[model samples]
Target chain A: MSHDTVVTAAMLAIGDELLSGRTKDKNIGHLAELLTLSGIDLKEVRIVADDEEAIVEALNALRARYDYVFTSGGIGPTHDDITADAIAKAFGLPCDHDETAMTLLAEMYRRREMEFTEARQRMARMPRGAAHIANPVSTAPGFIIGNVYVMAGVPQVFQAMIDNVLPMLRTGTPVLSLAIACPYGEGDIGTPLAAIQKAHPDTSIGSYPRYIDQKFSTEIVVRGRAQAAIDAAGAEVHAMIGAIRRKKEVVENPSAEA
Target chain B: MSHDTVVTAAMLAIGDELLSGRTKDKNIGHLAELLTLSGIDLKEVRIVADDEEAIVEALNALRARYDYVFTSGGIGPTHDDITADAIAKAFGLPCDHDETAMTLLAEMYRRREMEFTEARQRMARMPRGAAHIANPVSTAPGFIIGNVYVMAGVPQVFQAMIDNVLPMLRTGTPVLSLAIACPYGEGDIGTPLAAIQKAHPDTSIGSYPRYIDQKFSTEIVVRGRAQAAIDAAGAEVHAMIGAIRRKKEVVENPSAEA
Candidate 1:
């Protein structure tokens, strides 16, 4: 029941497109999976627009509360990219062009034989005291300031940066889960589910109703720290579901004489 | 460059399965669309676990900053559902079983001839001085306390509740968008895209790179309040893309292309 040792993290998805529904925020799900695998509990995920004040507020609040904060978006070369400035304001620091970032970016442009315009150079600016997060895919590297790590809004780049950063993070014990799926509705098996939940107070029983093909099916998932308890609770759920199904079948097909 | 009047909102998605990667949180995208269509700027979104303290802290911070806050999940018959209690604690109010909620739930159960156990009755609890937000699809109704509206975690039920509650909300002028997509990578047209963005300071232009059918594609979206301005910007982008494509085709096939 006590999860005090859980190493929790938060996500900040910064984009106006996500808010407008033009683009679905895929970074949250990716980060959730990545963090869970790394044994870092993703306690919270947030999506904010390109606005400076909103970004700063969310950044400050999340960074203060969670062990680590990962932000995706508002780091591109466009005018809407304001994450670097906002992070600076959140930390009460000045945003300036980092020479190291500029040198790396300049080298990339030179190798590709592309002009390093002012707009492209804008990507080189970071919060005064921050280290660069390596982006293996693109030339524009993500940055980390204090507990907050800023990455690209693009899924592939963001994922690569996360993979690069996760190994260095301290993690806790990985979580384990067990589930019991049946061809029944939640209302039909609510009682037994409640009983199992009450009996195993340490485990969490989640009832999900899924519509597949033409039928409604329910999946009751039991998750906990102890594997033995999870197995026992899952067995109880299966027994209860089997009994209910058998009873219903008998009632519907009385004698099978026809 | 400046929005004279901005009515911002935040979405809080609550579920541990999401954090554990067992389930992807879909409520944020749906809520963002709903809020945007209603002319309320969905400025921020947060996904948190069923933990009470985390939910309470996020609720307090978001509700205080934004004009409205919409929270999904943790409002169920299960013990893990702690959204109501958290909201109450956040507002420094006492939570108890409401007579009105009980009556509504009892009616729903009676109509379906279902047993209304203590666990089922737990859905009738609400924070004091909160108005009920109607849930058309489900028996468990949501509640509105101050700026925060608490609803179910299920996508269909949550969306329906938002539809029911949105008509009554006061909203600002809605932002509109126009987009043009082509079968080319963003890297191919970064310079011109940057130029267009610089020219249209009022409009936010986003360049998204998508991989479809093993081919790279990019979608340039222009968003702003002015339809005429957006139309002009879209026209310029189309012309720029057309020129780029023509030049590429000419270079690749000098003899057959003509």
Candidate 2:
């Protein structure tokens, strides 16, 4: 798998609860992980409030920029749920209840002996010429309009929808990564790390700092589609870390913590 | 303080680690909660990879739309830390090492008997004519340029910077909320709930469903700055729930779950 063959994606999270801090978004990370496993690159994520204009603007921007745009929340049976209408406006299409979605909801309600009200039926609405994304948790189905796949906010339901939708989309080459951790601050290794990154332009190297057991440590990860590139980059980073450790022994007095 | 005086903010979380799903974001939720307590409305959040163009685009858009734009990540001492350069480009200002920030970092390093390298000094760079946001966790100081505040990616450092910067900004009237949970699905109450929302247009009502105890339940929350409006809307919701319960008893067979 080559770097040029990578498929790209973007996610739009729609809800006032998310923007207001009432809800900590779990779907974005979940989708990012799922997309990675499916060989899709998640390029960007935007969380906008439950405003029609905001939703429409973000949806259009992401759909145009990426191969796929996944949206979560704002598809419920509430008054504030306006994702379907907003997505419709983004594509210049009319949004209405789908027969398949409505039938599924009706049957589920009938089994539970609950009345399928207008609000519940609202979940059936989607942009014209959209394909339905099956929901195994609840009968309310999500839909795919253009490149955007609208999903529920609930964690369980969203994951279920992803499981159903993943097989329907095309996957690309999976990204591979190698991580090397050393008990040193980022500043101690930043210079050489940059050189290693420059040497391996195809692979992206990230330095993440962690404080564990009252000791500063850094984890450097090299990621790329090419195994040889990743291996070369990883070896350089490992050598760099070893040199930095030897330099610390010669320059600074060794403390028990160090 | 009134509805018209509400202060709004947006957040831009920049990192490849986040977009790759290697790190679950902790700063957005923390900042959202902190801003809410300080009477600031967090209206939007955008997460982008470690790309300069993406950061500049999002920074410009969010800064223009909201009263304040808060950015987290990419302010580290690593090569991928390009946020400062991107922010400077966005504001059409030159990015240089701030004297105050550099002085602080130098003193901290000197005390620890460590040399202040160029990579470490990279944290001192900011858009020209920007004020510094102190980082108590680490010596690397964040900065405020125009309405956008650039902070560290590390959660501890980001939170400390927020603590230092929040007092310098203006806050609005605190928003209040009231929540009531009922064992009825959103569909069962959507019709009357819409009427309640219409009656109190100033307040926002959100319906969140939960699957608990093998039965479906809904939590309706009304939020606004006005207590009287919240009470009025809340009373209507409570009354509607009671009416729906009575109607359910007459229409369907009683069940232990209901």
Candidate 3:
């Protein structure tokens, strides 16, 4: 597959619990960080309910737009676990039990002397002509159909599956970031920061404010694939903050003591 | 404004930091929970980069689909903050500094002996014919244009603005939920649970699995507006779990010693 200059991806978080606000989503952040480190840009994320139409629409939209689309949740044994079927429908394929997945799951249950019930067998189903993604935590494997990779919603299982999935995908140049903490509010240095950002168009500068210990501060981060550009922009940010602080101090307490 | 029988909402989280995996989002969960408590259904959520085109495209889609759309982040004083502009363009309205918002911010800065810089004044800009949403944390207020409520990405300010915005909107009947936890995996009782779900079409049932203390368990939640319906479904859920456990025990521990 010919990839773009910047390898990009999108995430689809499918579940009624997440939309209902009953479950605080933990997979997106984890996946985002992992993808960044692996040199894949996470461009978009859409959280939809377990409804099949919602999942299919989002799956098609994301898979067509990005290089890869990863879906979390709704792959369990329960009826609400409908991501496999949705992905199948989105790609115009039939969903059924896969022999490899069934063998893996059946053996795992047999080793534990547990009856593999029909409901347990539901986890072995996958879209036709799809390859399974190994699950380190549980034997029920996730599968990949087209550019869409389906994984579990459980954080541990999701992370484990990501470990298996990342090596299979192509990686691009990783983005390097440098953070500089300034003891000033965002408003104090917003103008200079914008100028610095313009001076280095290759690097993306971000300003995040923090109000802790009864003091206001901002953390400015510079991100890009080039280290030289990041360093140049980071130095400009440091100098700008110093200049602002010095000007504020000299004007505010200009007494004979100076 | 009149709302549909189901007052649905969509959230747009606008920021480069979120997409870059530098910041873990907190506002979505907070808003989802708050909206649910206020009898509003949060149906969809989209996390997009700070790019104006992306923001505008998502805003139009979400606002068109849902009853209300809430956006968080990118309303700060920095150059990266383009939500106000994107929102204005989405509605084909003019973006400018509102007299009311300017006065609120100017007065707050004056009282604190702070200079209201041009960058700080950027927070006062809103789409024409917009209503400002009060920000108790910082004087830089959010705004409401059409059905979209734009608020700060900072969790503190976002929560405060939500407290102000909820009362102005019409609320529907709240959905009450009951949870029943069983010491078994989802597959252990998924078939019976689905039967229960099919039997009670009015209630929405969610199954979430957990692995803690080296034990597997699943929590089944039933949600609806009617107490009688929830109670009836809750009883079935309890009985189904009991029956599953009893059958498993009888099959595993069969003995004629008794």
Candidate 4:
């Protein structure tokens, strides 16, 4: 896509468990991968504790800066689930139990013969004018309010919300990424790779280093919106890797020429 | 720990791979858990793309707000690896090849019979007046400048750097945590849990819900610095869960009196 056609997004992950290291976040990666596939650039991500003020501040900052701000966590039925209220205050809207959400919860509870207690009812609350994002995994729906998508912290629920939300949002031209593996490590290829990157300013080349079986290996990923740009960069990186491999082989056996 | 004695930290993860979901971040979880165990509250985490301006802005913001700011990624031999340069700019310091780091790299490369090319030499560069965080997994070193720590993106290197850096930082009182398992889900226990939390404001109670075997379950964690406060809040939460379980059992089987 053209630079102006780029659709950018930011994610805010809200939970004390995540900040405390009690819960390893799975949603950020899930959301990021999906967004990238759908042609939205996940520009930034912020993980904050379940404090209301922090949520409000992050929500406001991210919502204003990106095309969409997707938040995971803090929408549960428990007391610590303050995301809905925080989003409400951030947008200067009243958060209350929405009749649509309340009805959804009520029906789900009745089918299971569970009481729709006040705690459960809290899940039905969202910022005013918010649209519901259906949760196929769970009964309580996530809400979309003014470009901010507030979803559950549970990995399954978060992914489900993304499934619902992705189809409805505006997406850019998908980013094309090609990965080339090289036996050479970063130290062996950094200079040539940088030159190739300089030659292809329109593409982004990333060098990922790995230690495998006591040998250093690297993966070169060339990403761009246009296929022609990606193909050009990828071919150059592959050729560079081959050249480095041959050079290293000749250095190891100087008598080969003789 | 008392409020005044609390030591707080923040983490900045710099890499396009992370934002692109090409890399699932392992450093954030490892750092968060270790910091929490070390009596440092990891208050926030930010993941930014490999953009120098983004890194500089996040570094300045986090370094000023928290006692310590830990960063992972972008300190590599490749061109995309610009974290050290960005950090230098953020702190208004000159970044150049450190004599100690260069010496270390030179000696290691010589011993391994590998060329210390310009690309390899790039790893030796760091911000002026920065202290080295040794990477045992790799020869390259991370650096600490002011309250900001710049580390590698690789998981093994990042963990090794943490092992070297954690011992030197100030810490708060270790937070005490107690978890109680409950068969009932959050909806069944949210109200009473809130009451228990309010009754012991000094402690933090977190409700983590799970769906297993098509049934709802939850784990309640009570955390505080004082053992007494944790025990007090924990006891209340335990008692409430038991009460809810008993009530639900009776409600489901009304013929039990026979």
Candidate 5:
């Protein structure tokens, strides 16, 4: 079957703090979930250092491969925040102060009555021929140059910008998922699960084991775009699990009636 | 100031589920932290699909560039789990049953009195010249071929294997950090923080803003290997904040007692 209809996106998280273990990158999970719900498939995620070369390489590769690329971090007022410059270099464009971005920066400083220094004005730099992404919480707006969308690295500000930006993008058919969990090991149900996948070729069966309260249990998650097929596959899984549970009960207490 | 005595590492997460937004790859954070604690700098992280060609390409590039390369996932009993095969292809070695890995797998199945099928036996395959990595949680052991370490995809199992394997490798001096959060806006502290970073070229200072109860507060984090430098930098940061707070109090009660 042709899977050409799926809209794919990639995430790039740039910072040394994440690599140094000083900060945990939380944007990956939040963006992945947001894209999934919007029917956009996240195809790849890369975390690179604050260095210019690393960011440029990742940005070029992902932008060429995926339909859309979203990047977080290195967009603040500090000298180390070089995401805007890196994106410009990757796309072969000049990094300069855009009037649109400068307007927003000036408005924010004017409201606070703070003297905006040249260091603070550094936030207004954007790649040539790009649009600004609105930041509802903070004013240092993220910008989109071609397929690469660069935003602030901080989780709260990044999330707010995503919420404002995602609605403007095109989406594909959304994926649906069905799940079942019981006290069972994956090996005992592997054969039946494989058979279900073969019958419903469009669906994917994922087996995840959860350890809760020091007890092991497995959750069988089935995902597809078709609802009827999902129900049919889910029914087969339940029957197979019921059979195994009954057989175990019979062996444990031979005299007990079911 | 030659900072060239640093051991660097990169993590490659191989799984389509992570890319497809079905699973959040937790191993990257855990590995990043573990590597940093071991004094090995985690420089980059990449998450790709289970495709052999992609895995092989990433394996070659990262292994050639970094001091150490760690890969998680795509090493399992299913048809798509081809990490061992890909590593063999990257190294131009034959993929076959490793004697040590086979012994460990056999002992594990024997303890539980379970029959090891051909599918389960697939876990024993490794590169021709690779060595086995100890898996404390399960029998499907990880392997180390050259600079690359191939481990399980599951979080708990991979973490246990890392703890067992990392001590055997050489490490560098670990990094240290100090941070303080105050009720101040980033706009108020932006200039002074920039000055602190400029004054101390060896220390890296980061500013993070959080919105709590609809008010913005910023956290200033400073990091360095030297204790004396960090103490001096932290004192300057506090002094700056004290000055800002005092100004705010004076502006609020201008006609009160001096």
Candidate 6:
């Protein structure tokens, strides 16, 4: 409820598939970008296997440290889907079939004329005293217990659940960033850029190098909680890059300099 | 250099850009796939900011827990490039510019007719007694200290570093995987699949649900250390899927059953 202070969160991506490299995780990036834009700082991310002990250990550690913890994967109908059980273990709660969830799922299946099979009923399981995070894309639901929000591994379902959870949490001041293109690489601007970063301690300046068209170039991105700080640091970076370009041109061409 | 036992690994992705959503990391997946295929179990992955303390703490934790710890990012020419410092601190050793790295990088710049600038010189810094991981894409080499492999964050450079490091380390038996496509979703086969999983304790069975073409589908992936176990689980999974399909067809088309 409080937006005055930073809302820090961590992601626990639980799945053997992720660790085994069977699934190239897309949820981490998607959730990261959303959290950044929403002003919630995603401070850390931990990817662990589907083993319940592994999930419980990671979940407990993360939930205690960060304001909110988001977990994806392992809440489906299969036996391997033990995230719900893990969450309960982490919070010292009981995980069992919830009447509300079962009723909703049953109604949806009945409308579609599909039987609510025993395995499908597994989807109704949730941590005691947890609220359901709607998965609009699918009939099954993801739940929130304590600070942890359990979501599906499927990208579409995870994304939909993310949308449902984002509105309920607290957010901090959105970060403002400005990027300056430097025709030169980090080697060319690192010194001057470090000076600018030190001069504006409020701004965090980063130099990213790219090799394009057989030449190396860098992009200096200045980020800060406030606009003025980012602009101040960004201006210095732009001027520094301009000076380097001119100096290089002059050194390469003595006649042009004269 | 022992390939008899399972080699475990953890990746520490260091960068504020990754946390800020400015850069979506491709290194994690790339390295994960490579490690998996190399018979190394990438057990866990941690993404932290470029902060020195964060890097040092994560590096320490990972290096101690896993057989090998692979770190990507924050090893460059900029002031934010503090991975080398962190690695050195974690190992309780001095981090200084190495003569070998300096010589190699210096010659690389000289060959290209570029100045060996002070910022570029930062790339030569490494933990005392660390071995350089060759970067063919860019002459700026990554260093390996103890069991930890420090690599460039750029996908191309990270990949090149991975190739250099893989052959040097020991690996376990390659994991064999079999994926069976099930037209029905998890709800239809989750119970039977769980039974098959219980029957085959050696194999790890995973049910992945997909929302495709406005219908639910699932893929059951069976993974194991040996072919016989994978084959045994694979056969049961196939047979189970076939039986489900036949039963569903009979129920949907009563006239066809006659």
Identify the leading candidate in terms of lDDT.
4
Ranking of models by DockQ: 4, 6, 3, 2, 5, 1
Tens-digit lDDT track for model 1 on A3-82?
63578899888988898888888888888888877778888787888889989988988899999999999787656678
Error of 3 at B232 (Å): 1.1
Question: What is the per-candidate TM-score for chain B?
Answer: 0.93, 0.93, 0.95, 0.97, 0.94, 0.96
> What would the per-residue lDDT of candidate 2 be over residues A170-201, giving only the tens digit for each residue?
88888888888777888888788898899889
Which digits, one per residue and each the tens of the lDDT, describe model 5 over residues B1-258?
Answer: 266367888999998677666677788888888887877889899988777898988889899999999999877755556799999999999999888887887887789766565656778899998888887776678999999999988888888889888987779767667888868867677777788888887777877766777677877888777777788889899998998888877777786437
Show model 4 residue runs off by greater than 4 Å.
Answer: A1-4, B1-4
Give the Cα lDDT of each candidate.
0.82, 0.88, 0.89, 0.91, 0.82, 0.88
After TM-score superposition, what is the CA distance of residue B42 in candidate 1 from its true location, in Å? 0.8
Off by over 4 Å in 6: A1-4, B1-4
DockQ of each: 0.39, 0.72, 0.77, 0.85, 0.45, 0.78
Model 1, span B1-258: residue lDDT tens? 366356888888888888878787788878878777777888777888888888988888889989999998878766667789999999999998888999998898899766666767777788998999887776678999998889987777888898888987888777778878877666556668878878887778887767555444778888777787788888889988998789777767787475
Residue B174 lDDT in candidate 5: 71
User: On TM-score, who's better, 1 or 2?
Assistant: 2
Better of 4 and 5 by DockQ: 4
Q: Which stretches of candidate 3 lie over 4 Å from their true place?
A: A1-4, A213-215, A256-258, B1-4, B256-258
Give candidate 2 misplaced runs (Cα > 4 Å). A1-3, A213-215, A252-258, B1-3, B251-258
lDDT of 3 by residue, A65-139 (tens): 999999999999887888889889998999999999999989998998777888889999989999999987878
Sort the predicted structures by TM-score, highest score first: 4, 6, 3, 2, 5, 1
Clashes of 6: 0
lDDT of 5 by residue, A12-106 (tens): 99988888777777898889888888888887789998899999998999999999999999887766778999999999999998888888888
lDDT of 3 at B179: 91
lDDT of 4 by residue, A95-212 (tens): 9999999998999999999999889999999988999999988889999999999899988888888899998999998888999988888999999999999999999999999987
User: Whose DockQ is higher: candidate 1's or candidate 2's?
Assistant: 2
TM-score of chain B of 4: 0.97
